[model samples]
Target: MANPKELDPAESPQAFYGAELRRLRLAKGLSQEALGALVFCSGAYIGQMESATRQPQKDLSERLDVALGTDGHFTRLYPMVTRSRFADYFTAVRELQEMARTIYEYDPVLVPGLLQTAEYARAVFRAFDPLRLAVETDELVSMRMERAHILHSPTRPRYWVVLDEAVIRRVTGNARVMHGQLAHLAQLVRSNRIVLQVLPFSAGGHPLMQGSLTLMTFVDAPPVAYGEGPYRGQLIDDPAYVENCRWAYDLVRSAALSHEASLALIEAAAEDYASEQD
Candidate 1:
């Protein structure tokens, strides 16, 4: 069998954290499975953390400290592994998304970031942080808008989105904002830059009722799945885990309306919002 690949700790903060975790675990004569059991997570998750494919959560890091007798080493380094503007768990996903050749998404609520108009995005950030200063909101919206560049890149990924009808039905930023948001989505579809389908309320409960999911495929690396949860997110790179997410996404996609039908629905929503504003 091939030798286990060596990790270069200096490559990144995440790499360093993973390397330290592995070293501490081995010194204690505990396998990944053992450590995971002590921490209430899966061995595969621990393996992903060691390989630097996943970031450790604050809670998990604390548990690792207690279990490995590392005296808070992992916890101290956790903040360094995260990006200031993004959640710690979402940093890896954002990096992978930048390199992906194709992106498939299922959003149960709110417009996906890549498709949000500036006004709509600003509204979202403000609502999420009503107490934030205006400058802070601007900075947040700028960061989100910067991510939209992926949609305009020359080597842009093939984008496909399946939206639950509630995403469009909800009035996020009043009638004007909803109208612009839906119109923007329709424009992307008309430009043939994206493939979109709406999973109508009539479809009833479905495979992705849990939350949002993004499956990204790369030209030179294995696929990954990023799942969103309340106040946190998860990035899955394990082959088997990614495949399972892909299967679920396929089910959700199948349950959505046909492309033509979905487009019509979006256009009608936009018109309704516009009329409401008038």
Candidate 2:
């Protein structure tokens, strides 16, 4: 058998947690596959956690406690690991986005990060971390922009977005920035690169009113759903849960304007922002 790669726990909390997990699993003489089976995730997921490429979810942590007989060692460390990672829940989502054949999203507030311009993204990062210094904000903004590269790839997922009217009307930075952001969205829509829909406020009290949700479908693997809030995120892969979220997303889509109408609404909002900038 090959020797395991060295793990430097001093790198980060995730590294410490992951190295400890690997040590415990190895001491128990369990293969990654066997361990993942006990924890109800994939061997690949276990590998990612052990390599510190992915932060273990709370559910996974509890299962690991029971499986490895760690008596809550992993569970107790879950929150600490999350605090040390940026976009904690999104790490897996980003991986899935690359492999997904279709990506569907519904956002009730700000624009989706996949479509955000640099200026808009910076403004969002600043708003999200009001106490963060410029260097920290720049790092996050760069990461967000880097993730957008999936859309620019030659073979990309078919992206469909249902944005609440508020997303278009709300200003992220200055009026000029908002105008540029909306204009960018409009160009993407016109180019057939993405499908855009606006869920009008007049529709009122529709499904997915509570928070934003992303449903991703792959050619081979099972579908997944990701729900996001201001400060927390959850990745749901259970078939039943993902199905219910998919159903709710369909309802939101039904309540949204048709593609052409939605494009017109977006463009109109951009013009409104441009006039204000004047």
Model 2 residue 262 CA deviation (Å) reads 0.5
1-278 per-residue lDDT for model 1 (tens digits): 11124678887788888898888888999888788899888675677678776666788889999999889998999888764223356656765667779999999988998899989998988888889999988887888889888888898999999999999998898999999999999999999899999999999988789899999986645577888876778775657778999999999999899999999999999999999987
Name the best candidate (by lDDT): 2
Deviating ranges (above 4 Å) for candidate 2: 1-87
- 276, model 2: CA deviation in Å? 1.0
Per-residue alpha-carbon lDDT of model 2 for 1-278, expressed as tens digits?
Answer: 12235668887778888898899999999988788889877675676678665567788899999999999999999888867754446766786787789999999998999999989999998888789999988888899899988887898999999999999888888899899999999999988889999999999998799999999886544677889886778876667788999999999999999999999999988899889967
Worst 10 residues of 2 by lDDT: 1-10
Report how far off residue 139 is in candidate 1 (Å).
Answer: 0.6
